[model samples]
Target chain A: MLRLADVSKRYGPGHWVLDRVDMQIPPAQSVAVLGTNGSGKSTLLRILAGVTRPTRGRVSGAPPVIGYVPDRFPAFDAMGSLAYLVHIGRMRGLRTAEARRRGQQLLERLQLVGGIRTPIRALSKGNAQKVALSQAIMVLPQLLILDEPWSGLDANAHDVLAEILDEVVRVGGSVVFTDHRESISGAYSTLAYRIEEGRVLAVERVAPRPRGVPMAHVVLADPGAECPPPSRIDWREVAGVAGVRSIDEAIHVQVHPAACDGLLMTALRGGWSVAEVRRDREAGRLGGGDSWAH
Target chain B: MGALIRYNLAAVVHGQRYVAPLLFFGIVLTVFTVNDSGPLANIYVVSASTLLVSMCWLTVTILNHEDPVRRSIQSVTAGGSSRVLVAEVVLALLIGVGLTVVGLIFPILSGSHHWDGSGLAAGVLALATCLFTGIAIGVLCSRLVVPRTGYSLLLALVVVIAVPLTPGLPPVNPALRLMSGNRPAGELLYPLSGYLVVSIVVAAGCIALTRYISVRRE
Candidate 1:
């Protein structure tokens, strides 16, 4: 957990860039700092990353290993992407071999393998951005901070970053980034903070969308030899059944609400005893209303 | 700090910024060796001055290559500004010492002049001290300016003004006098000691100032 108390930043005789902003970042979640240009989004991130010192107040619980991607990556004209990542990994305390290994993995994961030998300054902007992100993730940081992490990424790279952030949160790490594009932020973030006039105003937390397809729990008695093999059966022919997973004698069917009845009828007609029929609540509500009502 | 130093060394080599200075030093040595009509002391003086300027330029180049914003961020993530500054200063000194060896050895290798063991040692000492002084001034100037061209020009102007005005400063003046072969033989030990003390004080002071500026700027 990271907490800030009355943190403010101002230049010499200038208006406050950050005005006594207060914030908290809990573990296992992704938080976004949202605001317009020059609205202190980057300033807040810099402060959190410990790059910029605040004029007043205190910050605590900041992790020793922090991964930060600035809005603009510095032009390391002389170094190649892989070399730069390895250099950063070493600086973050990884051994030479480990740093190189992780650097290779991150470059491959981010689709930057082709540019591994290319000087950073010569790479395309999007690929350069991938290099920037790779350096940040070289070590599994306890707290990750990114400023407009998605701005220069292509579609595939964008999705890859989202998946990486999900993995970070899943492993109990925290991520704090700023993005003006609501579609991207809304899709990935668990909580958000809006900066207006240099203050952070809390926005309502949006619960995560349920993962995977809505699976219908179907329990059936052992099928006799007359029953067709589950793999050979075309479960899609049953109305609303999207897919089927058979575990021993029980078949877990993924179905749309309209096809739930059809799925049960097909099973009963096949002489399979129906032990129970109910929507998988853990799969999240499907299209709202009483998802389990049959 | 070790990693930072390694990274800086790699950056300097890869960027090839050291090429120009090394080439210039080589050219200076060739010119002095070819033009042997002048006194051996005069050759030493001119060559040492060129080496001093080259070392300063090398310092400026290293600092200029470092992006201040990126460095600040790296400092925060890596540890602190002092560690980064120490790495930079160590890198500059390492480069300075390496170049000093080359500069001092060229005259001997070319057989331009012959000197006894103590005389050769004194020459090496004088050159090394001057190079460090140059590094200190270069670092301070690099922090004060933004563009590389600006700092290079600024450093040149400073050397032009400072070299001639060395008479007013004691230890530095002695070191310069020794390089120029104007000091008495008996005064070598005293002046060399003074130069050593002054070099340490200046380098330390400049490093502290750079750290303070870096922190405050961030």
Candidate 2:
């Protein structure tokens, strides 16, 4: 278990690049570090990697056996991929043979068998990223800290990374990774945290918008002809339809974030009719209809 | 600890690609030999030049190549202190042994000089000392603002030129001649013991400094 409490960092004494941020990741769990640029995402990862110093904070945990994958690939010029991995493994106390064996295996697994003997300078960007990722997870570290791990990966490479991460988590390892892309699935389901203006905010739950086809469909009424299909109207643009409550015969009831009564009253007066509407006072359950029901 | 030293030495020596160090070694020897110097002067030149070049090679190997700071931190976090220690020691040994061989190889191979026992010992010591000093210098450079290879090349160039220039100073050359102990080149070169002592002390200081820096900054 890794716990960061009251962690803060300031460049000089002026603005805090990272304010008092608190976070915890349980063993065998995976967390996504989400934030806009300059949100202290990289800084936080560096602090955990023991690269950057936090100005004021108390971090508690075993010097978390952390495997760090930096955003930028810092390649060693002369060494080949095989030599690099074995060297790192040996540095971590494996025998020369063992290190070499592990290196070869990881290289092959990452589909870089051809480049294992090739110099690092000669490798392409994707190949180099594979090398970097393998080195980070070479020793099976307990805490894996990755920054922008999926930056340039194609679909296959992304899948391979996901497999690697899944294996890490399966073995009771913890992970914290940051990425700008949000469409990457499984991030919302797992532990998610957002960094805004140097403050780390923990997201307890991420309720994803209804996927596939939302069963609780929305119907808009013209009160003149038959209500148009739910697909015809852009659900997002229509003022209160986004927070859909429920569906009745020809009426789509929605709970507006601010005041629902005004829009409902306007719709009623404007003769954009609601054939049926039932609003729960406290629960805010708006029973609305599907266009097919009429 | 001894295992670590050996591992570091092996890694350093073997870190090269397809006899790359031999390229630099040949260049240094060729430069002096191609000049007006005879075989005898060339042999001495080889010893001094190897001592100078080996240090620079070791410095780059430790800093830019392996990057002790990043490797050490990675290993520690990976729960492999023993491995990190071994790699470092092996690197140091590789530097020392590598220089020693390069220094003695050309002299013995070319039959340039018949080394009496003291001459051989002094040559060995000088090579070892130079290598040790290089490792120590590399450790210091890791902490400083300068890039590893650049700093090492600059230092090696200065040492190669400056050490020889010390004897050319008028008032000091006379006194320096007395303290020369009959071995003019060896005395002109720094003492081996001094290099060894300096390497150990400096390496230890560097390790401490790195740990302090890492913790303080973290």
Candidate 3:
């Protein structure tokens, strides 16, 4: 976990950029920082990344392997995309061969292999952003911090990055990012914070879902007389069951469609027979009313 | 720190900024060889001064290329700003020494006059001191001033004019005094030692200043 206490940043004698901000980033959580221009969102991220120091506060518990992507990638004009990624990977403590291999893999995943040998200065804006992200994930950092990571990415690349973030969280890594696009924040963020007048305030806590993937609602037969009660079962231990609730003789399990099979297997192993499985399409849809249908 | 040094060395080499300094040294050596009017010592002095300017120019350019903002990021990523600054300073010194060695070789290759081994050693030491002093001052100025290019160019110009004019400052004027043949061996040792001590102090002071400013701003 990363914690910030009474963190404040001021430049010279000017007004504070961040005022008494306190935040905790726990493992396996995705946090979204939101604010208007000059509202200290980037400053907050920088402090978290240790790229900047707060004037009168303390920060602790920063993980050793942190992947940070600033708003703009620094100009490594003389270095090729692959070389730059390799350099960053090496800096983050990867062995030379491993760094090279990972650099290749990240660029390929971002669809930037065609320009691997091209100088960073020559890459297009969106492609350059991909390079920036490639460096951040080269080491699969335990704590990944990004500032406007989705700003210049194309549609396909956007989905690719979302999947990567999801994988990072699934493996118990933490992600903290800031983005202006509501669609992005709404889709992947588990917690959101708003920066208002240099103060950080918890705005909303979201229960993240797999985007565009429907949820599965399963009904399981009541446990036999010798078996434990359904409520006594720890559904969280099931591979894909996100949540479990028992209603009368039936048990309702919420899970991603991909995890439906795993959920059924776990239920059967626990002495509960599976009765039916159906897609909870309405529960999976975002927003509400007619607006969501579109 | 090793990675930073390797990255910087590769960047400097691949960027081809070293070319301009080498070319400048070559031009100065060729001009002296063609003219052949002045004393051999005079030729060496002129060539050495040109090398000093080139070394300072290269240091300033490489350091300025990474703006303070970028440096801050590098500092945090690399664990601290001191490591990054040390790597940069070491690269600058290595480049300066390499250029000085090449400059010293030019006079020997020309065979215009018999060169004493001690005199050659003293010349290289003096040139290195001058280069170190220039880099320290240049880094300090680059951090304090905006439009780094303008300030760096201005600093280079000042060093070129001031080093030859003020012969009392041991480090800055050693090359001039040594080339003139007026100073005895005993006299030269005192100034050379002073130059070494002053160089260390200046480099340390500048690095400390850079760190202080960087931390405060961050």
Tell me the native contact fraction for each prediction. Answer: 0.50, 0.17, 0.35
Per-residue lDDT over A1-294 for candidate 1, one digit per residue giving the tens place of the 0 to 100 score: 799999999876789999988899999889988888999999899888888778898988988888888888777676898898778888988999999999989888888745697888888878888988888888878888999997778655765686678778888999999987553455456788999998899886434434544446566555667866433345534544433446676665556544467667777777666777766664432222222211
Q: Label model 3 with its docking quality class.
A: acceptable
Docking quality band of candidate 2, CAPRI definitions: acceptable
Best prediction by DockQ: 1
> Least lDDT summed over 10 consecutive residues: which range in candidate 3 chain A?
A285-294
C-alpha TM-score for every candidate: 0.79, 0.65, 0.78
CA RMSD, predictions in order: 10.7, 9.9, 11.2
The 10-residue segment with the lowest total lDDT in model 1 chain A: A285-294
DockQ of 3: 0.27
lDDT of 3 at B103: 71
**lDDT of each residue in A1-294, candidate 3, tens digit only:** 899999999877999989999989999988889888889888899899887889989999998878778888766576798987777777777888898999888888778734798988788888888988887788787888889987777655765776788778878999999976544564557778889998999875334555556667788887678867654566644544544556787776666565678778777877787888888656433211111100
On the 0 to 100 scale, the lDDT of residue A103 in model 3 is: 87
Q: CAPRI verdict on model 1?
A: acceptable
Per-residue CA lDDT of model 2 for A36-59, tens digit only, reads 887889888877776666898976
